[model samples]
Target: MDLSIKGTNFLGYLPSQKGTQTFSTFSCRYQKSNEEVFHQITESELEIALEKASAASEKYALAPIEKRRNFLREIIALLEEHRTLLVQQFSKESSLSEDRGNVELARTQAQIQTYLDFISRKDWNLLHSQELNGVSFEKRLCPIGPVVVFGASNFPFAYSTVGGDVASALAAGNPVIYKANPFHAGLSEMVAGIVLQAAENNDLPDGVFSLVQGNDYWIGETLLKDERVKAVGFTGSVRGGEALLNYAKERKTPIPVFCEMGSLNPVFIFKDAFEGRTKEMVEKLSSAIKNDGGQFCTKPGLLFIEERGSEMFINAMRDEFTSAAAVPLLHPSIYNSFLKLSSVFDRFPVYRVEATAPEYSVYPQLTEMTAKEFSAFPAAKEEVFGPFSIIVKCADESEMKACFETIGGHLAASVWTDQSLSEEWMYLLSSRVGRIIKNGVSTGVAVIDSMHHGGNFPSTSDSRFTAVGKDAIYRFLQPVTLQNFKS
Candidate 1:
């Protein structure tokens, strides 16, 4: 693949724009060890990227839908051909295992293919015209122009460079400018090269797809505030996403910011299910907390259980969690934050539950508190962002209901029950989460047609749209109705 404007072997893309200014650059390092360096990007270079994206959208927005579908097909073909190397690079930059890298890379391709299939099916006749008295009405989806995607640290391939947001925006015929997560800088550049080559193979404009990398927040802010950028797609911490959203709102021409901030993803355990399958539930909850060191946005943070068999279940869960192996977080800042957030339970109200601490400085921690104690302290609801969970013992059904009311929005919420008295509890949980995962953990988010991977405030900026699945393409689509037109 071709290298970028930077004086390094590593690939990068500084979009062709007018009035580009020279920038002061910063170096990229591997997440764990800072020995060897990757490519460097400048905060000022983002200006050109946004300008080029606006220019590309002019052509891409008018391009035939079939041509756009062909672009996605070519991207999938290139991704498959370069899968092995991309996975290896991803594993190196990200602390995740090789198996996880392969799975995420494959999922990225599947996301693109899913969008392609949705557009091809004739049943989805989005372009339709109706004849009225002396006039004709036609309605269709139009691209919202230039969009910027912020890479997710957790799933580098699925949510990063050529991830869901990128595929969705491009599939909707919007020019995309991706701001790669600094944590996985090298991996982002590698994936960007593959995407650029695919774009070239299909004769896409230089601005149709551009990747910008930087070590500062200003770079992201610059893109969000740009008038040329019509929408923003992000997957990261609540603080970071909130910052970008605020910047977008502050702009003279406010644009829509689809920010998928992290979620608490609480799990409620009813008495019937807990008593019937104590051992099964323990293993399931334990397995849920171990994936990627509990770094998923859907990791169950607060678990509610009635006082009946709650003690025994808690003991079983503690044993399973402590015995499991420890996996480090994506970066050091995440590790530090994990320690500080989990340590909040070391106070008077909340206490440790026989946690078998890991050999490393950073590892999983388990804490416990009564519903009465948790209610006393509102700060207990804050997200810890690691392999940590708080088991809450409720006095009764009424107390549990009260506890549920105090909670805020979540991307995913789960309930473990035997289908007895589920209606009432499911209704109570309906407003708390975006997707009610029944009888299963919310750690795994599927890329499918009906999947709703977004939620109300605190979970995401806008609950009306999803960041995953087929519906995600609609985020970049603006409705256009033609009136008094000839068919």
Candidate 2:
């Protein structure tokens, strides 16, 4: 398992560096540029890659399920064999700790295994056959052709190359074109190489998997506009997802863009809940805000509480922030954006912890405002993508319900209460989010069959589908019914 980094695009099984335009991934840990300079995939190369993927889709989709299962197994074995190297590169490129990198690597492997177990089942394709009035009809899931996946910056392994999107797409028998996130191009290339090796070892199609490297927006725009691309998977900011969605719309034939954009993930704490478990709730909330530098899409950005124990919760949170240490973001751009977005709280009442953080790091802060003030302040609702949260105080249950109505869709909304919530509250919360949590933080997403990782409207393009879990494969599959077909 002597894997080496080439810092070039993987056009199927072949490594390409035909483009002169190049960029280097920055080492967030060392605060310096990585040694390898990666060549961007040119328009001509992208076209070739798309052509190969389009051609390969037919064969890959029709290939035996055993071959696909073997492909996934090989990928898992390779990832495990080179786990240490992958974790090291992941840590170097993303500035995340080695332990976090290992966790993400294991998660990535587990995600692939989930898909593997799904496709290995007898009912994997959801096939159905019925005969009525001397007519026979059969229906089953079919691949949607080539899919383009945009890697995310935060989780270099689990959400980036060889991540959930690629795994589910491949498992569903769809060819995948992975666009490497420029911030972690080197690590992405390394993982891409592993996937390509697995494809080659399993004798998969030439264009079954491809990696395109570039930072320019046009690279993604070009991939989205091509007719060969049947679907897309994206994980990033709202602005980036909007751009890709618009690009897909501009295409003569629109395609499904399954994007998991960031969310506010609000937490509602009832008076009783707050007063009863003030210390415990504060600890959980603080950990949620500070974990992974608050880079998770499900990080609780909004905290709603009744005015009765609002002061106590605020005082506890203030102490927690002051004692907490700061952590570095994925990149400088993200760090700058965090600073800019969190600055909106300067006009409001805010408490920030002062820490001598490293370069590209941010301190934890808690901002406060009344429900009336929150409603009046539009900017306060916007997600500040770091270890920052806003506490909204409400006069009573009515005011709290009114405030909840104003919030748009979110990935998940948590309710902390000892007793059951009202039907009205339950309905409102369930309607506004894809997942509802009780007495728990929304930071950790379980990669199980029942997990729904997407949300309504702005949280995701389609709430009906999830970006995680076995159901994610449905995004790359469509149903085809055969009439009067004889087996």
Candidate 3:
């Protein structure tokens, strides 16, 4: 594939080794070693980037809202200029289908446009609170200094360089340093060049946007622990996020680590909706289970059902899953690990439903357990992470409530119900999930201003923010109170 930017583009150029394309960059060695892997961009480069971004952030934050909106609008137009090529490159690297990749491409553009539209009217800095004692009190949102963003592997373009995290950070007037996913290191570098060009064209400061493409996790740890990095945004596994958070906590002046971890996002199937249209629900769910090969953070890992309708739903769901073919997970390591997990599940006492899938692809299966059996079994609560879901049966309303309470926190919880039942279940859902749904699969999350894509505890390190929508910006920002204003 041709490199993205033309002529003298430093960030766009990858270090080619003897005709082989190996994605490698300067990485911080954390384990008994002190060596810079790729000598060009070293710790000094990052320190300089941090200093420049921090200095520019003060001025960037004071820029008028209209100017900021214009900057993003220009970015959107430039992205549109290379839209087709960008989408194609993203698909080729990520192995996503044309339609799915196109949707994500559009979502990324929409996020930019949404932020543009959002800033056009919304005074993100207006502090209008009144005060007593002949003194005025007002609180407003301010940008935290340079933010370090660690992109998730599953989303290359939309969640990598200049993704939602970047969009929100920029909107809040914060500078960014993106650590791109290794799986798409080349693609990440290409997009990072575009962002830098956009920054230059807008007369934004140099070092406002930087990209570090490395294979190791230590670079991320070092960046997080850096005192200049005021905040962090991450989307990935629990193990990875927790490791980074621990590193941040160990820092002398620890910054906020907003890490979005794994979520066994559950889909609750009420009798009314299941009985209303069993086949449709089955088909809808089957596609969701396999969407993007079930790598989404919102992918439903657990399904709750009433005991009376469990059999019917299971049979239909099984029929759909058996026919569904699997795709390779993001990386070979993930695929190998998944196979091991599947084998372990097969040996467990938990009921395992047998199903068929394409050769080398993961097969979907349904494991059914009674209300008491499911609740008593902690194994059922674990997130299998790919095309796998557990069917937890509740004997009745009381059991269902207990099941929801017993279940761990999730990024999202879905409710499938008819009119009356939907109303009845809304209360239960509000308490159980961060993002609640009605009569739909929870796999496809729309990137919009109102969408709350993050959740409590294990779903994310913090419950107050989201990773996929306008709320995502909150992760990079903190409130600043200003007093005694003179106009």
Best by lDDT: 2
State the displacement of the C-alpha of residue 457, model 2, in Å, after optimal TM-score superposition. Answer: 1.9
Error of 1 at 172 (Å): 0.4
lDDT of 2 by residue, 1-487 (tens): 4568877887887889999998988865677888889999999899889999999999999888999999999999999998888888888888889999988888999999999999999877867989888899888899998999999999899998899999999999999999999999988888888888888888899999999999999899999999999999999999999999999999999889998886899998888886678888999999999988988999999998887866787788989887778787888889889889888779988787665677888788889899999999888778888889999998888888888788778999998889888999888888889999999999889999999999987889899999889999999999998889764
Better of 1 and 2 by lDDT: 2
After superposition, the stretches of candidate 2 with alpha carbons farther than 4 Å from their true spots are: none
In candidate 1, what are the lDDT values of residues 1-487, reduced to their tens digit? 5422232221123432222332221211232353434444454456566677877887887777678888899889877887778777677766778898888878889999988888787634366778778788878788899988999888889999889999999888888988878777667776777777777766777688888766567778788888888999999988999999889888999788999986888877878777678888787787777677888888888888877867788878777665666575777667778777777677743333345444323556677888989898776777888788888888777887888788778998887777664577767776667899767888878998889998877889888888889999888888888898674
Count of backbone clashes, every candidate in sequence: 0, 0, 0
CA lDDT, every model vs. true structure: 0.76, 0.89, 0.69
Model 3 C-alpha lDDT per residue in residues 1-487, reported as the tens digit of each score: 3444321112222222221223432111111111212222445545565676667777777766666777787777777777677776565556566576677767888887766665676565664677667777678777888888888878877888878888888877888878777655655666766676676667776556777655566678778777888998888888888899898888899788888888888877777776677887777777777776777888888787866865777777766665665575555445566667656555433332345534335655555667777677777776667667777777666677787777667888877877555455666666556788778877778877777877777788877777776667666667766676732
The TM-scores, one per candidate, come to 0.91, 0.97, 0.86
**Between 2 and 3, whose TM-score is larger?**
2
**Clash pairs (backbone) in predicted model 2:** none
Clashing pairs in 1: none
- Model with the higher TM-score, candidate 1 or 2: 2
Cα distance off (Å), candidate 2, residue 125: 0.6
Which stretches of candidate 1 lie above 4 Å from their native place? 2-40, 123-129, 348-361, 420-424
Clashes of 1: 0
The candidate that wins on TM-score is: 2
